[model samples]
Each structure stands twice: as structure tokens, then as C-alpha cells.
Target: MNAPYIHGRRRTFSASAAVDTQNAVITSIKTDDGATWSDMGRVLGKSEDRAAAYANTASPIDLPTFLAGCHEWGGRFADPLLALVGGRWADAGAICTGDEAAALTIANLLPAIIAIEADNLTEPHELLPHEVLIRRVHALTAIWLEMIATEKGRAR
Candidate 1:
């Protein structure tokens, strides 16, 4: 049985399930996104028909194959798999303006961080609801990542 997280129930990582999910990602790139397996093949350095077989199978795919497939269609389908590994994918083209992102993030993340216990729990008064916490984290992460990316862009 998978251990329960006080946060939530996350599934145990199954290699077989992950392979199936990878194959599904490949197939969706073809069926939903109108990406030819040949196009995926080019992306992954394979032949016109090479990726087609992987699209229809339960076999394990290379990391490049999984990444190329996800890149074609965006992360709506891939987020669960990424989350399973404690990872997230973001679009390189996402845009934000001014101090707008930081302001929005701060406004959303209510229940101020006044008391962090020695244990890991926040004081009851300082805790946001679970849904609010999730939203705030995503907001803060995007804002911070965009800040870093902007700085890197300027340095180039």
C-alpha cells in the first residue's frame, strides 16, 4: 500500500504505469495534436516510422521521446506524471508584466507567515486553506521563475 501523505494521496510510482502513460503521451501527440510520428521521430532523432511503433505499444520510451511528446502538446496531460515525480513543466513563452505577478501572488497568499513551528506546521492562524495554498505556491513559483528568467535574459 502507498503511504498516506498528510498533504494528500499520491500514487506509488509504477514503472509499468509510467511506460503506459508515456506511450499514451506519444499517441496523443499524433491523434490530438496532429503531430505525425515522423515529426516526433525527427525531434527524437529517429526515422519516419520509428516513433510510430512506440506510439502504439506498452514499451518503455527514452526520456527524449517522452519530452518531445510532451512538448508538442503542452502539459495538461503530462502534469500528473510530472507531479508524480515532484516536478512541473512550464511554457517558455509565458508572459507577465511589471510588478504585477508579485503583487498578485502576495494578494492571493493570505494568512501571513507569522509563526512557523519547530515542527513543520504553521500556526493555525497562519495557515491558508489547502486549495488556497496550492494556488499561492503556483503563483509564487511562476513569479519567481519569471524573475530569474528575465534576469538571465538581460545578462545575455
Candidate 2:
């Protein structure tokens, strides 16, 4: 006689890799279509080196601050500028132009995604879990919505 055996899959998370992917995505978006670091750098009111350094970090602490500053400077366009830097979908184009509730829903979910990446993933170098990566994509979309909302709010 043999007893049945079952094993559950172990889930892993990688905050570092998730953050890195996020940075790479953002960098790609910001540099797209002849956009220069100096143009974006103006948002931070800092020299190119300083702006690049802040953008390259894995931490999100500076992102919110930077975006707020950009809003103060560039007005409605700032939303799209920040969205581009956050790596929203290419189709997302500029900032979101409609749907306030939905946008906020997406924005609020980013922390959970970050938490998942911070918790349930590990590879040879500790990459984010597949689920977390998916969440990051979703978070990027949400950020786009937030940007749109920012622009719309300013318009009204």
C-alpha cells in the first residue's frame, strides 16, 4: 500500500529585480522619440548627472517627490512627462484623459504589487516572481491613469 503525496509550489519574490525592471522600463520610455535627459532633467532642476543618479536608483521614495516637482513646473504636461518616465504602455501615449475612479483604483494597487515583489520571489540573483512582474505592469498602467487625472484636474 502507498499513501498519496502532494507538494505545494513555493513562491518567491524579488524586490531588487522588480525595481530594476521598473527603472529600465522608465528609462526606455523617457528616452523614446528623441527625448533628452536634459529635457526631463529640467523637472528636477538639477544637473544631468544628479537627475540620472536619482532616476537610476531602485527606491521609489524620490519618484513621488520628483513628479510633484514636475507638476509644479510643467503643469498639465507634467503628468505625461512623469508617466513616460514611469514606463506606461506605449499605447498609453500621454497621460490619462478620462476615468477618474478607475485611475485611482489602479494607482492605489501599486503598493500591493511592490509588496508581492518584495516577498514571494527568488532566482539565482533574486528576481521578482512572475506574479509580481505582472503586477508591475499593471502598476505602470495605473500610474498612467494617475498622470491623466493630474492633467485633467489641472484643466478644471
Instruction: Count clashes in each candidate, considering only residues at least 3 apart in sequence or on different chains.
Output: 0, 5
Which digits, one per residue and each the tens of the lDDT, describe model 2 over residues 1-156?
322224322334466655564456446546653556676566556656655654598664256645544454443323333343442322324675433455465565556556656856634343343455446556567768867976786798
Q: What is the C-alpha RMSD of each candidate to the true structure, in Å?
A: 11.9, 18.1
Q: Report lDDT (Cα) of residue 96, candidate 2.
A: 50
How high is the lDDT of residue 97 in model 2?
A: 45
> Pick by TM-score: which candidate is best?
1
The residue-level lDDT of candidate 2 at 53 comes to 58
Best by lDDT: 1
* Per-residue lDDT of 89 in model 2: 26
State candidate 1's TM-score.
0.45
> What's the TM-score of every candidate structure?
0.45, 0.30
